[model samples]
Target chain A: DAGITQSPRYKITETGRQVTLMCHQTWSHSYMFWYRQDLGHGLRLIYYSAAADITDKGEVPDGYVVSRSKTENFPLTLESATRSQTSVYFCASSATGTNTEAFFGQGTRLTVV
Target chain B: GESVGLHLPTLSVQEGDNSIINCAYSNSASDYFIWYKQESGKGPQFIIDIRSNMDKRQGQRVTVLLNKTVKHLSLQIAATQPGDSAVYFCAPRQAGFQKLVFGTGTRLLVSP
Candidate 1:
């Protein structure tokens, strides 16, 4: 079952510390996305990459940064963690077509202390 | 900000009954809509999708209906089972945009 994987399934860090969540997909889908799930707010996009070295800001990119660097991997970094940024983060990818059925990774739950 | 949202926060249904989950979107330019089911402690799983050109599409025991005029989308599950319990989310994608704007989600509780 080589689909998508996320590292550090659960993490706890200090408010001012830096943390990075890693995402990798075997599909080489060409489009990868990072999203955060919060109560009442649903899933908010943090960042996405269309291809290698092509990244763009999403709806909630203020406290986070993302880079593609490689087509198979997309990593999200929290330069300075905050309590408000503590939420379950998910990574997704979709093929390049109309039936671009996006697939999601198991998600990483982060707790900012 | 205006976004894709669900009409209900939760829905309680019994097994063997029909379940209908509704979502509302404000993006009129959206051309593709999808339904995803997410279980506890896991990421969302793709269920089904319907394009703006079609009003209905069906799959194994699941059907997705889209109404462009009202900007509404609904997922209908037939003979619901306990395994069908999960948070359902609706996501819509605008033309030329690969990213999807997701709805708030509706939690479905299927009781046996």
Candidate 2:
């Protein structure tokens, strides 16, 4: 496929364990982002990368870590998963413009037990 | 993760009727706002966007209105259809920034 993709459309992990969610885009977009959707709170940005090797924190990035070593790949890791960390994670990519619309992948539903 | 139903604010409308969804933000630095539609089990798709400098922007069947004074934005759909039923979200971004922050979504249900 030519669009963005997310691994393990669904995942279940134990609390305090470590898990990493993978994101890949074929467009080689310059901007990639990770967001979590929960009840009452819409899609909140966890981390975003402007380009390769450049990442920044968003509104909620306390327990999440992101890395972007390659333009086509951006992975998010949960150092110590907690119950509160359970949510639907979405990965998106956009071209090199500030006004460019982002393209999102089918979310990964992560459940922490 | 497990998601509960009926938690989001919903707007129920009959087919052929006009629908309007509203969103509010408190960030004064937000320079651009966009409306997105998300179907079940799918990611959001952009509908329309309006910048802080503009008051209203119109698309094919959707219109976005931005009110910088009160920090309010709205998305209006003309002639609602069953296919238009989905969760609608408003995202705001600061100037010179690509990071978008979304607001709580409103689920639009169109009855045929």
Candidate 3:
């Protein structure tokens, strides 16, 4: 209850629909990241926020959007969910990006139909 | 993301035997490397990390080796146990950057 948490451990959504995955951390970490895990592809970063108001795109940012209005919360949104967008989503936080090990939350298994 | 890759996707080892997982990274800018273990239905958990300046680092039952010359890294587990059966991933991060590139994990199976 003191670490990071993700909402909707599992989700099933229709294509072209909008979906948002929630992430919250209690440590008030300076960095928050969203990664999607797919078979044979490993974990790909979709978006990351350095602080409360800064966010940037990673490798795969096509259908994903992320915002960090608060230091404790960073939410990822799929503007138009596609079938290929289905994957296990992980939210992680770290005190800094230099050498600090990130703490990950329980992933959200999302399937787009 | 940058490519962080492992040699094998699956490994089967007898319980009590030592296990080694290998990873290769291509980014010369990466300054930190870490190994993570992901149990079924869970996110990747940090196991150990070694900076670019260090050649090796050890944890409780695991050791990580970093070869900046060849841009490779490895994780070795001593006395592998059934509880160690999980997917292991290696991630390399650039200095002062928050985005970490994760390698395709190696599934380690410890058979009793």
Candidate 4:
């Protein structure tokens, strides 16, 4: 497909385990972002990358880690997944960070038990 | 403190009626705002956007109104259809910031 895609549409893991959600975009956008959606919180940005190898923390980036080595791929990793970390993750990309509309992926549903 | 919140959690309207979903933001300095529609098991898709400088912007069937004085944003859908049933979110972002903050979202149900 030519749009953004997220891998492992659904995942289940135990607490203290490490899990990663993958995101790939074919548009070659300059900005890629990771966001977690939970009940009552809507979508909170976990991390965002302005370009390859230039990632920054977002609103809720405490337990989540993200890296963008390539413009097409941005993966989010949970160092030590906790029960509270169970939420739906969405990956989005935009041509630029300012005033540009972002396109989102299908989303990854992660369940931590 | 960044907070964007929707006034209604759920809205039920007739298929031919005009639906309005309202959102309020705490940040008065936010210049950019966007409305997204998310169906079941899918990511949010952009519908319309309005900037702080503009009070209202219209799309194909959607209209977004921005009230910078009250920090209120609204999305109005004309002639609502069954396909319009989805969760709508309003996101606000300050200029020059990479982070986009989304609201809790309001579920719009169109009854035919």
DockQ of 2: 0.67
Q: Which sequence of candidate numbers ranks them by TM-score, best first?
A: 1, 3, 4, 2
Worst 10 residues of 1 chain B by lDDT: B1-10
Q: lDDT of model 3 at residue B48?
A: 97
Clashes of each: 0, 0, 0, 0
Best by DockQ: 3
In order, the interface RMSDs are 0.8, 1.1, 1.0, 1.1
List the candidate 2 regions with Cα displacement exceeding 4 Å.
Answer: B1-8
Task: Tell me how candidate 1 scores on lDDT.
Answer: 0.93
Residue-wise C-alpha lDDT for candidate 2, range A63-102, written one tens digit per residue: 9999999999999999999999999999999888657778
- When summed lDDT is taken over every stretch of 10 residues in candidate 4 chain A, the lowest stretch is A93-102
Q: B1-112 in candidate 4: lDDT tens per residue? A: 6798899999999999999999999988788899999999999999988778899999998999988989999999999999999999999988777567899999999999
- Report lDDT (Cα) of residue B98, candidate 2: 85
Q: How much is A4 displaced in model 2, in angstroms? A: 1.2
Cα deviation of A10 in candidate 3 (Å)? 0.9
For candidate 2, give the lDDT of residue B19: 90
In candidate 1, what are the lDDT values of residues B1-112, reduced to their tens digit?
Answer: 3398788999999999999999999989888888999999999999999888999999999999998899999999999999999999999998788899888899999999
Give lDDT: candidate 3, residue A71.
99
Query: What are the per-residue Cα lDDT tens digits for candidate 3 across A14-68?
Result: 9999999999999999999999999988898889899999999888899898999
